[model samples]
Target: MRRLLPRNSLRSRLLGDLWKPLFCLLLLGAVAVFFLARHIGSSVYDRWLYDSAMTLAEQVRVEDGKAVLDLPKQAVEMFEWDQVDRIFSDVRSRRYGLIFRNSDLPPPPEELQPGQSRIFPHWVKGHAARVVAVAVPNPADPADVLVIQVAETMLKRNTLATDILVLVVPVLVVLALLVGIVVWRAVATGVRAVDQVVERLDSYGPDRLLPVGEITNAPAEVRPLLNAINQLIRRLSDLQDTQRRFIANAAHQLRTPLATLQVQTERALREPDAARHGQALSRVLKAVTRSRHLAHQLLMLARSEQSGEKALQMQEVDLAVLARDELERWIDSALQQHVDIGYDGPESGVEVYGEPVLLRELIGNLVDNAIRYGSVRDDGRRGGAVTLRLQVQPIMLVVEDDGPGIPPSERTLVLERFYRRRGAGGQGCGLGLSIAREIAQRHGARLVITDPPQGMGARVEIRFAR
Candidate 1:
């Protein structure tokens, strides 16, 4: 069963994570504002109601110890036409008395006592009414009871609350949307700097190490990352400059000696003594051959160190045939040293793709190096047998010898340029294996050295990629 993974849309997820919290906070704030407005509005209305009630109660008088209200016309109008009703009652009798009230208004249920107030639910002519009852002492006559009541319809109060909500909700929504847009833009602006840096780095290669010129208006927090990127560009440019200088110097130094040896060899052939002339000719030829080999090795090393993808002119070549051809070419030298050289593999061709000339050089160098350093034995033999075998399925080439194998600790060291082993007999430069390794790397192959089977000799294996 496959489990579902979260979808990969960034904007959707960002909104999903942000909108809930933001909406909740906005809703809480709106509710708080609504309740606060309602409380303040109700308190102001109650104060107006109390003032009107007190002023009307002050105009009352007592006739023979009975209370009578002398409410002014302005005081009566102060209740407002929208108010539900008004009433006066006797506080001692606990009964309603002179009620100069509108027929559309509901009366209070009971009279109010001295210093007492009550709110009553009233229905007046198809409208809701809120009635307040307050008690007052008769000022002119003692032992007289009076009560005043005020009522107002709730239509205006409901309209005001609704108006406040209508005005407030839209403003809150607009503010929330504006805040969301600002946050998204700010985040995008900040992250775009990193995007530009990545694009510049992606376009870079060994040939181009220039820093990105565009600067971001990022916050101070991200300054370190931009600084580090600039530092890396500087370091890479320095390394590339150093590598170019080294290659140039090596080519110049090696070419001079080669040119001098070629000139000297041509001049030395003019000797007249027959025997001496032959010996000198042989020495000159050997020197010329050594110089040519050195030049070839140096060129191969320089090409391998170049930083880019090389164009490999690959073709299918037979490994067994190539190995046999190289061995036959070196047959005379093997016979002189009394070394038995042989190639062992399938008679049919084993095909591989690479530069055939480079492959031949790689195989030839391994075989030659084995014969030179692999000749000494405990039985006092001048040369030993060298065998080259190709394993077709694994795409491997193995060269083995009865000569003393390199020690385990020095196996890696021998592959370095000009690194010669102790007590080894060799006249040529120690670049044969190094050149072979370089060519193997270019062909996407690995060269490994280890003791051969039966612990008798060294085995060199070149394994090619499939």
Candidate 2:
């Protein structure tokens, strides 16, 4: 029943909802009213029948050893007082036959012998009637009895029913209608708050991200929806801020390399000596490589952010095998930096669900950043070991580098693109940690940076919930 109603209009759905119960009450009330009226009418008419019979019995007297009658025509005519009703009377004596009766009146089923009388309903000249029969003692002879019966048509009973229903039905109907009106008005008033909310949302735009004023007065039933809508607006505002920051950072990082490339090309054109020209060309090539790396990192960041919207194309793969594979790709770079980097885990069977290529890129970014910024020791010595440890306990991955460890204050800051800390000198565009964080989040994993137990290097742990 609830599912059948459309959600758009509350008033139409609930209006006249009271009618169902009212209608059922009316059905039950109809039976009750009918029986009650019939009982009242039958009581009144049955009493009148017995009174007329008793009166007729009074006139049946025995005088001088014989039963005699002195019944007035006026007494009989009074029984037919209603124009719509017909009346009948009969009198019999123990020693005599019928003394008086309407010729068309139907006889009682049993003979009214002396000292026997009863009251019952029987048809009279094709019309329904109530009858009363009684035995009366003779005034002179107590042994002998006179029988008297009287019947009357049911005009007064019919009139009573018509009058009662005409009065009762309207009062109930008016009460039902009034109650329905009151409920309808109350429903419409209560839902006015929701209508105000709809009007506010109808004109909403991206610039208006604040909570709606109308919500404070809204009914409690709709508060959850209002709060949820406000939360959506806040999320959209945060997304807008992130996009602006990303664009500004990308532009700033690209400018320096591009300007350096332009200057180096001009210097190369001005130099006539082949060796110096070759040196200038080399500088220009380095600038181009830096610019290319920055652009690629920007693309990776964009892809990771959108991974939430685009469903992950996943497959089960061995994390140990994937990390080792990426480790091999970075070996040459680690050697160039004199960084002793290696995989320290099993060869296979650390399985997880992920996009293979993206997972590989996530590992490569973390390892590459370690080799670039993590090759120096705290004592300012170069060529230190950076280990990639994949542990099966709790399904975790840890990357530790014996380099100048990140300061506690800058640990979280480094995860933001282009956010570098004090004395953090490197060739990085500050997107390596950011890219790794995004990829890990996409895989339903948590990434935390902490100092290793030895307290001399930074440790990054990626933990996946089981």
Candidate No. with top lDDT: 2
Please give, for residues 269-366, the per-residue lDDT of candidate 2 as tens digits.
99999999999999999888788888989888877776755689989979999999999998888898789997888999999998898889888898
Candidate 1: which stretches are off by over 4 Å? 1-282, 303-308, 315-318, 376-382
- Candidate 1, which ten residues in sequence have the lowest lDDT sum? 84-93
Candidate 1 residue lDDT tens string, 205-233: 75898866647586575677788878777
Best by TM-score: 2
User: Which residue pairs clash in candidate 1?
Assistant: none
**lDDT, residue 414, model 1:** 91
Q: How good is model 2 by TM-score? A: 0.72
